[model samples]
Target chain A: MQLSAGARREGSPWTGVWAVFLKEVADHLSSTRMRILEVLILLSAVGAVYAGARTLQQTVSEDPFLLLQVFTAAQDPLPSFVAFLSFFLPLAAIALGFDAINSEYNRNTLSRVLAQPIYRDALLWGKFLAGLATLALILLALFLLVVGLSLIFLGVPPNTEEVARALLFLLATLAYAGVWLGIALLFSVLFRSAATSALAAIAVWLFFALFWGIIAQLLAQAVSPYDPFRPESELRQAEALVAFSRVSPNTLYAEAIQVLLNPAVRSLGPVLITQLQGALLGSPLPLGQSLLLAWPQLTGLIALTLLLFALTYVLFQRREVRA
Target chain B: MVIETQGLSKRYGKVVAVEDLNLRIEAGEVYGLLGPNGSGKTTTILMMLGLTEPSGGTVRVLGLDPVREPLSLKKQVGYLPDSVGFYSEMTAWENLAYIARLNGLPRAEAEARIARVLERMGLAEVAHRPVSAFSRGMRQRLGLAEVLLKEPKVVILDEPTLGLDPEAAQAFLQMIQGLKAEGITVLLSSHLLHQVQAICDRVGLFHKGRLVLEGRVEELAQRVLGGAYRIRLGASPLEGLQARLQALPEVSRVSLEDGEVRLEATQDVRPLVARTVLEAGAALHSLALEKPSLDEVYARYFQEVRHAA
Candidate 1:
């Protein structure tokens, strides 16, 4: 009688999201790829931090922000902690997300999973949230490790401003990771083969990280040729270059980190000589001013992440599951 | 009716995958969708499960519209897709547990039901082993166990016994019969006719996106073959036997093959043919009646369609 009347209660679209999220997190934690990436990041962090502390102790022992210097200071033959992260974080995020959806197709499990009493929204959201949580866990542990190393090397705890700035830097890093995760997820939905999606995600990363800066420089020069007679032309050229480079997420993340970890960074754009005439030189800005300077780049990264994820959602919902 | 589709049609661009399929299946009946590959059997199944949207018409499973209420419809329908896959790294129990959680089953009840289904599927001994180590037959049974975990009212299987050996295919069909015994409606699709013919209470023959014929297997055989029985006779002297067999009132047609006479008739004509052979002064060596087989029916139906086209 109930079947004839069709009075079955409808379930929510998010009914099974938590279960999917937990299972994905467990899989990521136990996977060999995550283990390899964790070791790679940890080794680079320890090496960079040790080198940075040695250089900072010799050069800036009396600085007020000695704790922050440990993150920015770099010795010869090695880059700073920020540089190492900018290079490795994208790879880590890509590893977590490149095969997220296509692997389900490859294994022929997509239809079986979708046959349950849940919507496709739950599956996609669950996988994305799980990736972000895994990235957050790794980044948080790395942050604590760096701070503890700073305490041992500098022989002083960080001030409130320094801790706040460092936390902002951590948030920016996570957002940067999210951008790459979105790209990987997008490619996973667009391509049915896992290998093709993985390669596509890596290709996007490579374009932004290695080639985008040079391409921007060339394009800006072509658009706004420099003229010696008019110095304003040089400024216009420089502004064009910055605008073009900002389209790349790598550029946005790098600028945000520079302003958050180094308090002396007061402006992200080209500044005139008259603007700095009355300002004290080499003095650190307050935490609020530093955050204001990095706000646009920070939001840009988050927006890009959201845009890619939306596109991926649309493509995934339209995909045929028979493959 | 437990499953009904009215004028259901699906089109991808200009290609019509399924067209104007009007199907109705009653509760607890084992209905077979019989066709060769690319005949739209799988496409129809996908529409019924709400995995693919039909370009026209409607589908109702257990009185719930699949497109409008997929969540509730899917909850009561168990689907075993062709070549069903699993998380090979996880144990069979772990995989089924994930499905249980998705179904919103409580932890204790999920565990108890999982154990029961695994045991009934003969997978209890290997429940803790990773699915990568399972053979093809074992994996299919595991897929069936996963389907059973939901306690669904209707089970739709797409090519359930596709690649199994003869013994395993027989065992699998037995399990399908078991589902029918429990008063569950089953809809299975397969290109292999004879395998499904043994179990289906009623079958629909599909051709080029259309249900060309639908009825009970015996009825289909009568309609396609033009007769339900074929009688074969062997005698010492086959000269006048063919003429005598053809002259009988009940026999429709008679042909001589391999020194024996074959008769196609509407009903049992073995006794009448034997009497005719004896009356002709020929020694009766062999006389046997053959039931019409699904293979013959399917082949003959397609031949007629080709001729008509």
Candidate 2:
């Protein structure tokens, strides 16, 4: 065989990304773990929407954004739809991604897959995108279910502003889920064992979800000591607390949802008495103002997701394919 | 050459995995890389596939640099790793289809090639059965089927027959011979000498991250054993038989054990030995000539290397 060196071919690094993405998405959707999480999220969403709509129907009041309230209004035992989502969305995202890369290593498939004519970039991106797409599909279904239930119970069609705010809320929720997915993927790449990666992802989630608030409070107090004699110290300490807590993705998601879902949420930080002067006390802010208020939080969630994914990409590329 | 490497080396921190290696394999030949585990055969294969970067030197496969033009190199080269794995939940066809897609085969073409390769590997009967239910031999065949899906010009198999039973290992060797018959350049790494000896055209022996020996099997046996044949003579009146056989022109050495005369000869001296036995009035019970076995060649070469060290 007379063979000469062919000219260097510049095939795109994304050559096989779509194939990987399709396979991963199929695996995630068909998995039993995802089915269980889907059932849990669906039940909570139905229960929360039922309770919130019941409450709204009893109250003979003129609330323009009654549809939005179905997501935020809490009953005696059941938290609102948004609350349920905030609690379970991270778990769902982590479940989809915790074993993404490590399972390939465990099964001894990484080397075989890498041996194909594709860059490592394609595999990592494909897995991450598939995870994000799965989360989006589930969240979208849940949102529509809540909306349909609210319309039936409250006998009210959501206004344009309500629909817009709800859409933004959904986007923020997806970004929130993306952050946890990124965390799970990063752990999956860092640890060789699937159990270890899952544990590490859950540890991160628990820190931000349950322990971060207390830790942030303590840190703020230590940084800005409160003094009874100086009233301004109280405001300074509150500012410090907000700054410290915002580092957690959970805090960012919560703040973003507050502004997006609750148009009456004027600010996320301490408000001075003078700053509230001449403001319409009871009126809801316009959709634009609400989005502007939540812009920093929304961007923070996206940045955290990107940063985590970038770190995972670098680590996975540098890693050896051998098990 | 289909695959060539010059001054190739790999070091993992303080430990040298492969050091200053030069290897060349021609097209349409089955080249066996023989080594015990951790002798750098797998690492060298990885470097050639661009799956692992070499710490020094260069590799070219099918006239393309594995590092600089990996996609092009990989498209023409198929690598079946040791203990190869697939998504067990997926069917045999699904697993192969995924590999075909990664090679950027069109949907119809991918399906066709998958069907063809599965049939070729004798997996057509269970094409839709999940791989988890497959036995070890079946999985190894499926691994080969995956490699053949690309219709590669060169195929590299690492420890392809490691855990197979004797019957299955023999069957796998026949498949490798089939590949060679189709003019595919094959590089297979294995520690099992006799099994691969039937299929490999040439072999390189690896020891402690170095290519200690490389040549045809018979040539290696000649160089290491100092002769290629062992002739055993069973004769009555074994007295003076050892010195007599030792003095023969064709024989290199002679020994007497268990009332039998054993002689290492450069060629077949059976006729001469028989004539001498009859003239001496010795009854020749059984006389046999043994071709040099690779197992013996490997053992003797290592023994010599050990003694030298």
Candidate 3:
């Protein structure tokens, strides 16, 4: 019931979380980095969508609704949107996160800020939240532009199913960003230099996005001596390789988004083999089923990011502020 | 005492940066930690600030455990590290406001406090300018301004004047005295002995992580200089003066260093010598007194470290 005057000064009920959050945001937001990121993402999203609209205008009709009708008539709009966004959103997410944590530590400013009466968890959480918030803000602006322009030109409110599909796409995109942000933060924590951190993060991103699929295919082909083109056998072999390829976050997100956005898809095909024709044999899986199948892979990617971040926190705490 | 330590030592693997040291600093006292490079003065200060851990000692600041209670302890204490730099891209105002907010000053209060400190420290002219443009001295001033914005109970500076111009250093010393007027406990470390001599109420000379000597600067000097006294007798026969001084039994040895009588007095023979000089009819052109300077006292200790090495 009694406290000394001295003890009163030792612990503030404020964990100093918000202060660190605002400061971390301020560190990047004030500089040209934030502006550069915003400009690059907005321009690319707007430009790509505008380019798609232009291409549709030339091929189908000048009327945007006519273009939408043609796309929906050919195949479900969900799959088409999924195909379009899978490539764009990952780029945006990677751009937003790639250096969030590493740059601060590289600049020798992290320790100075942490030395203030803030918990390490707050600092880590604050940085993560700030990066996520910035990404969300950028995404929101892009969403408004894309949806707004589409609505104005098409002159039709998106149907319930289409809206639901769009929402799923949004969720998957955000999750994909989470995966990148985690890896970036992890790399940031693991590496000492901003450039090195960026290089390592980009290398991991590229490996997952482009190279892993090819590597898994080659590995699958080398292991399968039978005519991998035989329908059922080819299907089994393709699924095994697909499972292996899904281990990389990029491939999993890309494929999952494709499935979620394409309402028409029944399956991803009988796992492709040898000639790559067998890969297209299986019917495309439905959006829901694809997501269910990819849940473990998605979670594993996110967990890996968190694990890297936790390791970084430990290392950061162990570091001596010699400078 | 505002700050006290008991045998504080810090080891970085094989390197003993600081070793068994005892220090006491009182409130409103300008305590100077004097040492050359790598003498562990900075290491000691960092330990006191709870920034570094002592390998085998305890440090208490403002009656709080610095290590276990750093946040609470730091809130009441301000530290200006040697070569402390701010966010170069931020204006001085922004940098100060950032640190103030970190210290839990609300936005409005932080702005007001930052403005007042900047004005008081004469940093207002360039307050809005990015810190990257600030000169070394201006940056130092801004650093101190940031600390003062918190209104800390104790201020600890490491080499605060090391990179300042002579004029700036003079002004800075005056500023420190003003801090004393406000009852702020100031602990500053310096390699320059004269700087400590001018501003410090008490000085501690550290070498190899240990405090070799500490006292009110004048007292330490007096203790060393008290061993010898000069007796000057002008016209009269030296026999009476010499016999009287020697027979009094306080003088241990009498010799002339440079044609001036030097007495190795067993005790302070000031009164006896004064009376002897007057009665002996010696014209006291000047009873020139000599005392060991803080530098001289430190030199002897430094020699010990050298010899031991």
Candidate 4:
């Protein structure tokens, strides 16, 4: 049973990638950290949905898109499900990926795994894809739970257009999560200590999610300050702020989700009365128009994700596995 | 040749890790790459595996260029890196199964191979246990199991017994012998002279990024130190016997240490030495030919290289 011919299987070059993907999937699913993160996110999602449901009961009759409101509804005491996800999904992505590369290096398994009949591209790709797959699964489950809870509360099925918009929003969220996962993987490849990579990933997330908006606003202010006497300066100031905010993946994701989930939102930027002169006053945009509005933001998020992965792949390939 | 390298070199900036290495290993032969730490043994192995690209020259494993088609060569070759690591969270069976699946083995064949490899490595009983609980020896054994599971045509082991105890090291050497018996060409690198001497059919003594000496063990000894003999005497004073043996035309040099006279000779002079010793009334307890141990040859070779440099 020599392996000379058994190994040169020409058909499936991705066997190693698939094998690594399955192994990583199992590791992530069975890990205590994953379980804890899952519980944390699940509890937070349920808490937010319950609060949203309580607040939606009073306005269910007035709101035609009651099901869509379940995602964005927030009472004085609780945040919305989308808000919770925007804050917590990054944690899940980072948690799943912070040690993806460094742990293998620390354990001395990277060399052995590379010694097998697999390319480095496959190994790294498998790990990244597996992390994304896990993120997808968790997001899918949370979305289903949110929908299930919202259905019981509203007692009304969502329209086909609403469902399509929500599904697009879900996909946008996955792309958002993928961006963070790629960043975490890049840090993992950069740092030798898993703790360092984890901390770095969390720090980046905190900066983008919490501090980046304020910093971007300040920088925009410095770049284009408002002169109250000159009303045109206000437009320039707002444009500067919007341009700076787009640098953060958080802003891009939030804007895309807002457009997808709320068809009433026509533009992410400030709009003038002249632009809305011929439009219906209170009608929502069609699903296609909503997607078109969010396309740029979605493309930005996807490009960020790919850029991170490309950097990681280059670093991993150039690195000496044993030194 | 199962393995070949032509003027292979690796340089990191200005520092040369391996320089102009020309090596060849025949099929079914056990070749040892012996060197001290930082002597380029690991670098050479990495170059051969195409894990590290050479700055210049070429390498072929099993008639395939490793750099052009590393995956192809890797398919027919197995490597056990120094301090071989597996996923600690997974069981031994799980780790091996993962590797099997990576090699494109079907599920049933993978399971069967895993069982056979684990049984052969004496880890079948603990196959279900997590690898974190395994001892150093057990991990080394597991590393061997990984390398052999595929039955590769060529096996490369980098410091296979670095941390093993005496018994484990012996067991590892025996397993390397077993690989040769199975018609597997093995290229193992080690800094330990005795370990390489015991298992290697031919050895290349690497020094300062260059192979300074290479040949069979006895042939290397003869080339470096010449034909020699050691005769132990029981007499209180061996002055007369030493004089008589040194006076013989066949003897070139003589030295005494711990009541034993070491003789450097151009021919078989044991019989002449024994006759002289008996004639001079010196008690002759044992007579044996002396071959320079691999360490002595290595030291001498390196010293010569240093002086030349």
Model 3: per-residue Cα lDDT over B52-145, one tens digit each: 6678878999998876788878788888877667778889998887787778888888888988999989998999998899898898888789
lDDT of 3 by residue, A1-323 (tens): 24666545345434676776787677657757678767765665555455555555556433323322322222323234334455555555555456655555554455455546555566677777777777677666766676777566555576655565566666666777777777777776666677787777778767876788899888777766347457576666777787677677677676655565554344454523455554444444444675675566566656755776677677756655554
**Which lDDT tens digits does candidate 1 get at residues A1-323?**
12444545366778899989999999999999988988986887787789788898678337777767777878888888888888888999999999999999989999999999998989999999999999999999888988887788767888888888889999999999999999999988998888898999999989998899999999999999999999999999999999999999998998999999888888887999999998888898988888899999999999999999999999998898898
Question: Which runs in model 4 stand beyond 4 Å of their true positions?
Answer: A1-15, B228-235, B238-245, B256-261, B266-271, B274-291, B306-309
Q: What TM-score would chain B receive for each of the candidates shown?
A: 0.95, 0.95, 0.80, 0.93
| Candidate 2 lDDT by residue in tens digits, A98-154 | 999999999999999999999999999999999999999999889898898888877
Residue pairs in candidate 4 whose N, alpha carbon or C atoms collide under 3 angstroms: none
Off by over 4 Å in 3: A1-14, A54-115, A187-192, A209-211, A214-240, A265-291, B54-56, B222-291, B305-309
RMSD of 3: 6.9
Please report the candidate that would top lDDT against the real structure: 2
The regions of model 2 sitting more than 4 angstroms off are A1-9, B235-240, B255-261, B275-283
The DockQ ranking, best first, is 2, 1, 4, 3
DockQ of each: 0.64, 0.69, 0.33, 0.52
**Alpha carbon lDDT of each predicted model:** 0.91, 0.91, 0.70, 0.87
lDDT assessment of candidate 4: 0.87
Per-residue error for B270 in candidate 3, Å, reads: 13
Q: Write the per-residue lDDT of candidate 1 for residues B1-309, one digit (tens) a residue.
A: 999999999998999989999999999999999999999999999999889888999898999877668898888999999979999999999999999998889999999999999999999999999999999999999999999999999999999999999899999999999999999999999998999899999999998899989999999988888888888888878877787788888788888888877889988988888889889998999999887778778898889888999
